[model samples]
Target chain A: MRVAFGEAILRLGEEAEDMVVLTADVAKPTQVAAFGERYPHRFLNVGISEQDMVDIAAGLALSEKIPVAVAFAPFMMRAWEQVRSTISRCNLNVKLVGTHSGLSASDEGSSHQSLEDVALARVLPNMTVIVPGDREEVKEATEAAVKSPGPVYMRIGRDEDVKFLDEPFRIGRAVVLRDGSDVAVISNGAITAEALAAAEGARVDAMVIHVPTVKPLDAQAVVSAARKTGAVVCVEEHSTIGGLGSAVSELLSSEYPVRVRRMGVNDTFGESGTYRELLEKHGLSAPHIRRRMEEAAEKRDR
Target chain B: MSSAVELADLRHATDVQKLKERIREIRRSILEMTSIRGLHLGSSLSCLEIIATLYFLKMRHSPHRPRWKDRDRFILSKGHAAPALYAVLAEAGYFPKEELRTLKSIGSRLQGHPDLRTPGVDAPSGSLGQGLSIGIGMALAARMRGSRSRVYVLAGDGECDEGQVWEAMMTAAHLRLGNLVLIIDRNGWQLDDRTEEVKRKVPLRGKLESFGWVTYSINGHDIEKIIEVLDSAEKSELPVAIIAHTKKGNGVSFLEGTNKGHKLKLSEEEYLAALKELEAKPVCE
Candidate 1:
């Protein structure tokens, strides 16, 4: 996934003279190394200064440059004020890329894991938030981001080998992986795979909604998907407050009030562990999602 | 070409007297804007001369062409001074001066602070101390793009308290952004208190110098002197910081020299008095 991001940026740099990359001293880890090396003049490494990185990106946008600032998900929120005031309010064309999202940064401890980025980022006006599930999705999503106007918050994970099934990707559109009438498991990012796995194990007919765009969300599609399934279960490797589950809940409550069982980290940070261990500990694995889905489906039937 | 001839030509081309008239028009628009939608009237007052100098004398922009790519970039780092920039930008014909009446109104492009959504504004700023870093980015972009167009940022002394400003300074120096110019509005007053008591920047020049920026200090209210220094920074091959010493409430006598004048809603009587005080020709130009 990281390599895909680098390749997409490299292509963007060739076409868009104004396309520049900035790292909060996290380029190498974020897989922006190739873009940095190829375009040294355009790459800026403001060592460990996330706040400065955001402000500088806004400035570059002011000078008619397309600035892409890269960092970990947690650090992106650390400079949240700069993002709100400088980028969003200014309507500067800045692309904020956060790597190592959710439990994807397994073993890096809870502090490095960002489970609440989507919830907070979406609340800000004029910010488009995206979380691609795998390598192919990352490439497609980033390319779409470069063409889109205004501010964007894109989240990618640390895992590189996750299978990215060949599918058309567009900003703010949900990809329905299956058709089902009993239940729908809506998910994003790394948890999309888990949602697929959960659907396979479900006793009743189930479907998966792979929504990459969390903000300026496809409300109509999500509501339609919910109405079809009758019961919905939102799965993610993020917090329940403001991640995929929360957004789905907000939409459902206002538009299509449906029963939703949210399967994610419930208000607790993950401890240091392997990816699989963390998933099990936080009840974010396929089994947990399946269990939650079955329970919600039974309740809906009642 | 002789240096004296070039200086004389620059002055003649700038047309200082015509610029003064434009400043009056800007002031009138600002007053009208405040009457329609009250904003940072006091902070706006503090930066009038600097705004006038940049738009009229320093910057290479055509009022007819606000989106000209090669024109010098200007960011109001002290976003609270939006009223001043809006006034000047309108008078300079970036937009119709009538749009000034929509200052801070709902659905109006004129936000409380400088925002790019508004025409002619490069970046949005309300959070203090981040504009400088944005300016550095613009400066660096111009350098990498091999454009001679410069980036100028006007920062408030009070905003220097933010640590991010220093971080931006370090980045700018490290990059040797010769096309960037920083003009600090040393108005001495901030929101609730004097800058010295709040965050003493007594050795501001020394601090910037140590950070590898070539420095200049001038009376901000003096349009001619400011024009000279600004021209120098534009021509220089190193990032320069011009500390413009200024009064908080420059044109209005009663509010001048006091921190209390930073943000206030003048009474009907006080508003008239302020206008009367400003009716007289400025002491320096």
Candidate 2:
């Protein structure tokens, strides 16, 4: 995902000379080093200071420069205040790329996992939150974020090759990977691959919708899917409480009012383990999503 | 090259007495605007001279063209000082001085903090420790464009307690942003108590120097000294930090050096007393 982001931003830098990339000493991990190596003049390494990086990005944006600040997702939490006060509040044109989101950094423990990032990013007014599913979507989302006129927070996973599809990508729009009417499996991030597999394995005839833009969500598409499927199951790699699951449920409960089941980490801290083990332990694995989809489909029949 | 020469000419052409008079008028306007109930009174008062020096003599900003691309930028990091900044902007003809009364009111551009919506405000900042980084960003952008514009950031002593400020200081030095100038309003007092009492053993100058900034210590209330140091700092080849020692609530004898003046609505007696004191003092001693 970071590789895709790096390539996309490098291309963007060539077109937009005012595009500056900032990092807090995590350039290699965030894959921003590629952009930095190519455009050293436009790259800013602000050491291990996330808060300063965010505020600096806001400043650059105010100066009419498109600045993309990259860091580990959990580390971005340190600069949450600056994000809220400076970037979002002022509605600056700054792109915040948070990598290694969710349990992708499982071995780094719960402290490194950014399960609450979606909630934090979406809560800010004038903030657009996006979680691209794969390498292709990551590149698309990075381009969309740069084009956005206001603040954007793009959450990218550390896991490589999470299954890419040659689907049309647009910000604030969801893509239907497969069409079914029994149940709607709404998911985002790298976990969308698991969602697709869950629908197939369960044979639940589910409508699989992959949402890359979590905030400013394609509400019309989600509503149409819910109305067609009659039941909804949300999947994500983040916390079930405020990530994709909660976003879909919130939209359905208020607008369409459907029976919804959320599949993700129950409100609990993550432990150090392999990415696959962490996914299964947190009920975000393919099998867990399959069972959740089956339950939603059964409930729909009853 | 012409702008630098114009700035130098303006610095000499400026009348010290007239600048002091403008400061007095601005101070009076701030009091009148905040007579009912005000926020950040002391914080605003301490940095009056610093801001006055910038808007009147130093900064290369055009009130008529507030969004001029090559103009110098000023970020009020210590946001509670919005009234002081507003006063300067209005005096500089960014807007009518009458708009000062609408400060902190609903549907008014003069928000309690510095907002970019207001004319002449380059960036919205009320959050502490964040403005320095924003200044760094602006400075970096200016350097990238090869513009002669400089970025000035005014922060409070207590605001320096935030870890982000140190991070920005390190970044500015590392980036070698010579066009950035940070003026610290070392007014001694904060909201709850004296800054020294709250954050002891952390000398502002020593900390900045250690972070590789060119540090300058000056009396903030002295308009001439503020101008002189700013001129020198602008010529330096490194990021500059001006530690301006000032009274918490300068110009008002009763409110001076008192934390109680941090935020308050002046009583009838206190208001009258403050006005009388300000009126009695000479424009420049």
Global CA lDDT of candidate 2, please?
A: 0.88
Task: Please list the residue runs of candidate 1 whose C-alpha ends up more than 4 Å from where it truly belongs after superposition.
Answer: B1-14, B28-37, B282-285
Q: Candidate 1, residues B114-148: lDDT per residue as tens digits?
A: 77667787667778888789888878877777777
TM-score of chain A of 2: 0.97
lDDT of each: 0.83, 0.88
Model 2: CA > 4 A from native: B1-14
List the candidates' TM-scores in order. 0.94, 0.96
Candidate 1 TM-score over all chains jointly: 0.94
Question: What lDDT tens digits, residue by residue, belong to model 1 across residues A1-302?
Answer: 77788888888888877788999888888888889899898898998899999989987887778889999988898999999887887567899999888877888898889988888789889999999987788888998998889999999888735764568788888888877888888988868888888888588788788889998788987999888877999888788888888899989998888898888899988879998999999888888888888877777732
DockQ of each: 0.76, 0.84
Kindly report which residue pairs in candidate 2 clash with one another.
none
